[model samples]
Target: MENLIIYPENQKQLQILKSLLEEMKIKFKSEEQVEELQDWQKEKILKGIKDIKEGKFSSNDDVSQKARECIK
Candidate 1:
């Protein structure tokens, strides 16, 4: 892996890399590769949607006080 080096200094280079990596199925093995929030946040949103679907929680007044605080 030490032989691998990425220097995306130009649009052509980037496009070439995008194609080559896509063709080769080369994967990024680095921490920053995750690039966005992890699975827990996605799970929380899914759970909230499921709760709303199931009628498991809440009324407007439950959140209205917090919403009013935003105006202050």
Candidate 2:
């Protein structure tokens, strides 16, 4: 059998999915549930988001050579 990954952003959507799956009698195993963010990761992601929001970003090549796609 193959595996299917289902990701729902919030509790409402997750509850909806649970109801539907229960109604259909589907078998599923939820290993780990997504939870609230940690301070460090949240800060990092927020910084990145703010950078995009404030138009603060680097060109691809500024960070890595591989990102500099070339054609000849």
- Top candidate by TM-score: 2
Candidate 1 Cα outliers beyond 4 Å, as residue runs? 1-34, 64-72
Instruction: Quote the lDDT for 51 in model 1.
Output: 97
Angstrom error of the Cα, residue 47, model 2: value is 43
Candidate with top lDDT is 2
Residue range 1-72, candidate 2, lDDT tens digits: 888899999999989998999999997767565467899999999999999999899777665654554431
Lowest lDDT 10-residue stretch of candidate 2: 63-72
The alpha-carbon RMSD values of the candidates against the true structure, listed in the order shown, are 11.8, 8.7
Relative to the true structure, candidate 1 reaches a TM of: 0.38
Clash number for candidate 2: 0
Least accurate stretch of 10 residues (summed lDDT) in model 1? Answer: 28-37
